[model samples]
Target: MLPGLFRNASRMYDCTSRVLQHYEALYRLVGIPEKEMMHSIMKNSKFELFLMKVVQQKVVTGLIPLLNHISKSNIEVDLQEVFKRFTFDNSCLMVLGFDPISLSVEFPKRTYEKAFDEIEEAILYRHIVPKWCWKLQRWLQIGQEKKLRKAWDAFDRFLNQRIASKREQLLSREKTHLEEAKFDLLTAYMMQEEIVNMGVCSKSNKILRDTAFNLIAAGSDTMGAGLARFFWLIATHPSVEMKILKEIKENLMVKDDKKEVGVFRTAVKADTLPSGHHISANTPIIISLYAMGRMEEIWGEDCIQYKPERWISEQGGLISVPSYKFTAFGGGPRSCLGKAMAFIQMKIVATSIIWNFHFEMVEGHPVSPSVSVVLHMKHGLKVRITKRSV
Candidate 1:
């Protein structure tokens, strides 16, 4: 059993312990063991086309403007913040059928954005401090817990408002007319007649909110964080960056103008690992991807370097590594559903930025990992951008 600290922190709405099962309890659409929702949202080929369209729109409407402003002014920009807002707006459009304009020049503040940040930070802190310490603070509703409560309220209110608006809009439209409207993931879930057959309006509402919450949170932040790290690493290693740019040009034909940027499963089925390691048949095994990625035994002598050549085969095509060795997008049935979408988004943004501009890290700006579920730059990656001279 775990300590009381974790046990107490688990009570918070922001807590994400596997034991909660809120997704399952709130709605069958999200919780269905056979992945019925995934079939509609991801497994279908139509979803792929939908994601492609979204990526194109985001690049043109959200990213290009930012680029134009940067190119005109020739000023340093915080790539990390830009990526976060870009992804956030994109995710909202894909999931909620709404764009918050988070990527605009003003960087207008939004309550939901604040809420998400607060909740994530509080949850991360819970993992660090003693259980009783947070528990006592939570009981008194003071410190971070108080902030969490306020954020939780704002998050709930924002979602509920959006749900009500979408519901009203759907009801007002004729069935045939509704088909012409863009379909976001939440709309697909809400329109599922099966979700309605399960019970009354209140039950449906709970499920809708839970489903929306999960999808929105899941689709946010992570992709952008990865992009930031990828760019930072690429920028620091000129050889690697050049190789990546050359590969992109050779493969996608992206020109010099672009100064750009940027798992799961378990089973105890086998008694012996392929490495000749023996274990009891039912023994639980956990794979540490972090460790596996750096192991010279598996990756050869240059495992530590950020080399893009390692990914290219002799045939000049991308080499495919076994899922076990590269657990980035994960593997098997539980692999990331948004892997393709992420690739498309990253490709579009990274290629555009790299060809158009060159990034120089602000001198002496420390870059380190933040303590959170996602790997983010601790102080954020501060950089100066200049247009690439052809």
Candidate 2:
């Protein structure tokens, strides 16, 4: 659904458009055309670099305060939850231009955070059940759908509150005739009613909310999930862990004892298959990247193995595989616009953890992929963290 919606020429079907129309009045309003406009704003190179700097700053500041506690403690932590909270906080800061303080010592509860969780879980559950089942429940206002409605209300309230606050700030600044200094993604969208030539309005509370939602959806747990898997796989494979550590130390000029989190920092052109099959525009096509990465035919006999060495060529220039075969970050123009940003975040987080702590999987701990839009560990990644001598 994401890929198809991201297609350059894709348009919403009457049926899907009607479904959105039914719910539009109940939530912040945004439509297909607005979605395309937001996509263009995201793909802007200057905007992306701004976001990259935002993320980098967040990672450094967000993690430094947590290190002392983590490194001093020998107890196991739900690393999965840690990253999720961290990413959530970071995403909020980047998207809303305000911090929710979700990563505090007490891990304080906030309405917006709870609402975000509820809405995401409800949406994922909707995907799992039969469409008619959820739709009927929605109509009847019962069960999970009822909960979903409440969640949506809360979510909208949060967005509206923030939008109102930002608007007030902008208005006050206008009275003073101050320079427009706001640089958050949401702020950028709010400043522009439209790119006249582009024929799209990026303004409105509804559009602001929608753009923030899209950025969070793209920026949050997807990276956390990848980080969790990377840690788990490396922990389970000593050789792989050693190789990663070696590369981090020697290839990248990262010091092993840095207290600060180390700074880091595609569209399908065709509807036709190689087999002469045609995939209609706006069709919901599912591509399981998990399956693709391990496919024997595409990745060779040892595709199942966790071998980082395979990625390095004999000449040591780094092996390059076609993007389609290595669709982890996806392929084509619709491919993840944050591929580089993700790598930077992951490396900084990964290197910091590996250098400062030894991760030991809890004995008999069960680990499997959770069934969600993002692939997280089923029962969470349980591991003891012991400080390493650098």
Candidate 3:
């Protein structure tokens, strides 16, 4: 309940880390399903309002420009195409505050982006069944066992390298030893110069790597898919789009003087081969995803039906929606620490396309939920995007 920036950030950080720790044991712990923590955090907590502000600001600020540009470029992207990268970008930023440039239209090789994909696929394989089952398979050199073993080893290699690299970077830069002792979680964790008495912490690094990867895997894809669904609903529902656009034109639009929304290409890093923008705490984006769903009045009969009018107030003003009813970032003791961070990438990708493009299902694009750690479109969200006239 602390007010202003940094108000509850420290507390939030503590809880986030705890949740991360709990996730390390998720596979071993039963009855606790994958992604259950995220749902429990959002649906069953008090920080709902705080979560929404973070997500909404991210959309309105960080993501909008990039989306707008993409839509304007005569490019084509299906639902699956968008969500895959959309969620990937959001997840990476949330986990490491480092943005992969692949999401950008100008991205070159896709190294960092592919690395994330590899990590995600590996996480999914471990969770569907039990760890012993995987080991059992490895003992026999079974079908996927080889691939799984290789993937597991590769994943560890990547994390250890990253942890070591970050440590070296910190040592070189902070030589003065006079700078603030404050360091983000990753740096602090990597700087454990003292070796532990047991391998408990060392073995646990694999889980840390997996859990960090899961943050992107679970948080990014699910939210990205949800955003895509929201956009599909809004775009297909003209009345809904009108109301949202109206609110933007009235409440958020600027005249010739106010700086137009900055194109977010700079928000994501542009160089570095497989490039991504560096997302920082300084310009965090708020997702406001739940509000997109909770405005019953604007949507009417079934605001739940993807109607946009629900976003407009009864008096035609841009209305406020309660975070608890609409919260996607979640609330209470363990809301997503990267909630605002996720919002920036998600909103930009979603809003830009919603405002300018209409997607049509490909001849026989199947739409079913792939039940796993995150909600994936069973057959991928395939569609054709047609630009809306200016």
Best by TM-score: 1
- Report lDDT (Cα) of residue 275, candidate 2: 60
Which segments of candidate 3 are over 4 A away from where they belong? Answer: 1-75, 104-135, 174-211, 256-304, 307-335, 340-364, 386-389
Full ranking by TM-score: 1, 2, 3
Q: Which stretches of model 2 miss by more than 4 angstroms?
A: 1-53, 174-181, 192-202, 251-259, 262-284
lDDT of 1 by residue, 269-289 (tens): 757678899776565454545
lDDT of each model, Cα atoms only? 0.65, 0.62, 0.46
Candidate 1 Cα lDDT to native:
0.65
C-alpha root-mean-square deviation, each candidate: 8.1, 7.8, 14.5
Q: Which sequence of candidate numbers ranks them by lDDT, best first? A: 1, 2, 3
TM-score of every candidate relative to the true structure: 0.80, 0.78, 0.56
Number of residue pairs clashing in candidate 1, backbone atoms closer than 3 angstroms, sequence gap of 3 or more or interchain: 14
| Candidate 1, poorest ten consecutive residues by summed lDDT | 1-10
Go through the candidates in order and give the clash count of each.
14, 7, 24
Q: What TM-score quantifies how close candidate 1 is to the native fold?
A: 0.80
